[model samples]
Target: MTSRRPLPPPLELPKPGFGRRTPPALFQPIMGLFGLGLGWRAAAGAFGVTPAIGDLILGATSILFLYTFAAYLAKPLRRPATFMEDLRVLPGRAGLSAASLCLMLFAVVLAPYASGLATGLTLLAFAVHVGLVVAITLAILRGPEEGRVVTPVFHLSYVGFIIGGLAANALGYPEIARWLLWSMLLPAGLIWGASARQLLTRVPPAPLRPLLAIHLAPASLFTMVAAGAGLQAPAYAFSALAAAILIALVVSARWLVTAGFSPLWGAFTFPLAAFASALVTLSQGQGAMSGIGGIALVAATLVVPWVAYRVFKLWPGGKLAAKTNAAEA
Candidate 1:
C-alpha cells in the first residue's frame, strides 16, 4: 500500500473456514524450501557441513512441490480462472510468478535424475514466466488504474529472470544463464530504487513491512550468481550490500514483525535462505564472511522450515483471497 495509499492496520487472525482454495502464493513456502535446500547445499560445499542435510531438504522439497502442485492444479477443475486468478491481484502476482520460478528450480532438482526433462521444464517455466510478464504489462496498460501500483512483490515479476538464469547455469548452460542473469541487473536496480523510494517516503503498515525482506533476496541472489560465475569483484560488492541489508533487517526486526505472525510472515523465508546461500558461496569456507555465512545458514536452517509449516497451517483456512486483494487495495 506504500505506492499511493495509506497502509492498512495489522491483520486480525481469520476464523475457521476462511477459504477453501489456496492461491498460487502457496509457492512461497516451496520457494523457501528451494532457497533453504540450495543454501544448505552451498554451505556443505563451502563449510564442509554434511551434504546429506542439504540432500534431505532437497528430497523433501521435491515431495512437497509435487503434493502442493497437485493440490493447486486441481483448482482449475473447480474454477478455471484459478489458473490465472491470483495473477489479477497485486501480491498474488508474485506468488504466481514464484510458482513459475519454482518450476525452474524443480527442474534443477530433476537434473541429476533426468537431464532432458530438467532442461525442458526450465524452458517451459521461462516461457510461462515471460508470458506472465507480458500479460501483466498488457494488463496494466489495458485497463484498471489501481493495477498501476508497484509493490515490492514486483521483484518477482520482472527481476525474477535471475532465477531462470540460475537454473540455466545449474542445468549446465552457462552462456544462457549469463545472458539471463546479467541482463536482469537493469530491472533489478530500477525496481530496488523505486521500491526503496516508495518505502522510505510512505513506510508501509505493520502487515506489509514483512515484504521488505524481499529486497534482501535480489542482492543475495545477485551475489550468488556473480560468485558462481567467478566474477569475484561484483560478487564481493554484492556480498557487502547483502550484509548491509541483512543488518538493517535484523536491527529493525521488532518493527518489521509488528503485525506478528500473519500469513505475510511467509515473506521472511527466501531472503534469509538466499543470503545464507550467498554468504556460503562468497566465504568459500574462509574468513570473517564465512563466519557470517555460518550464522546465516543456522538462521535459515531454523527459520525456513518453520515458515513452511506456518504457511501450510494458513493454507487450509483463512480468507486469504479476500484479504489479499484488500491488503493494498
Candidate 2:
C-alpha cells in the first residue's frame, strides 16, 4: 500500500448570526416577505392581471429589494474575518460564493440588453451573462472542497438561465424578454436543487445524483423544447426526442421520490415533465390540446415562485439557527 498523508483538521465556521445583533430569525420573515412580494408581482404579470404601470413598479421594486438584500449579504461576507472563516469552512467555497454573487449581479444588469440588439444595455447584459457563464463553468470543472455542495448546485442556475437565453434567440421569441426569464427562473430552481442536494447527501447512503436530477429536469425540459423548436430537425422528430427524454426523467424521478426523497425536489421535475409534454404536443402541428397545454404551461411557470417561497421558509441562505452550531461544527 502507498503511504498517505493525513488530512487537515476541519475548519471552523463562524457562529450563526456571527456579527448580527438581531436574531437570525428576524431575517426569515424578511426573506419570506421578499419572496412573496416578488412572487405576487410575477404572477400578476403572467396572468395579465396587472396594469402596465403596476407591473413595472412592482417588478422594479422587487428587483430593488432583492438587490438591496443581496448587497447587505455581501457586506458581511466581504469582511476579512468572516471571509476568512468562510474560506476555512469549505476551503474553495467562499471564492465560488463570491463568484456566484458577481454572476448574479452581472445577470441582473446585463441580461436585458444581451438578448436584444447590441445597444449599450444589451451589450452590457450580454457581456455580464457571458461572464457569468464562463465563471460558473470554471467553478464546476475545478470541483469543490470537502462538505461544500450547495454552491456548485446553485451555480447551475446560471447555466440554466444562459441556456434559456440561447433558446430564446434560437426560437424567435421576444429575445430580450427571454434574458429576463433566464435571470429569474433559472437561478431559483438551480439554487433550490443545490441546497436540497446538500441536505439530502448528509443522510445515510447519499442520494446525491437523483436528488440533483430532480432539480435539473425542469431546465432541461425548457432546453429540449427550445432545441426541438429551434432545430432544423423535422418537427415530429424533435418532439419525439423531447418526449422520450421527458418520459424517462419522470419515470426515474418517481422511483427516486418513492425511495424516500423530498417531494419538494419533485416540484422542479414534474413541471418540466408537463412542459416537455406540451412541447411534444405543439410540435406535431397539433393544437387539439393547446388550451390544456397552455394551462399546464402557466402552472409550470408558477412552480419557481412557489419553490422559492417554500425554500426560503425551509432554509433561506442555507442556515438553520437551531442546529447551526452542530452542523457547521
Alpha carbon lDDT of each predicted model: 0.78, 0.39
Q: Cα RMSD (Å) per model?
A: 8.6, 11.7
Per-model TM against the reference: 0.87, 0.45
lDDT of 1 by residue, 1-329 (tens): 46787889989755333223656666877898998998888888887888899889999998888787776666666566655555666557767777887888888777767889988998898898899888777756665886686676878778887887677667677777667667988888888888878877987878889888888888888888777666789889998998898899999999999888866676788889999988888889899889988888898889988988876776554455545652211
Q: Give the TM-score of candidate 2.
A: 0.45
Shift in Å, residue 222, candidate 1: 1.0
Residue 291 lDDT in model 1?
90
Which run of 10 residues does model 2 get worst, by summed lDDT?
Answer: 20-29
Candidate 2 lDDT by residue in tens digits, 244-284: 54466457655545544322242352334334333533433
Cα shift from native, residue 59, model 1 (Å): 1.0
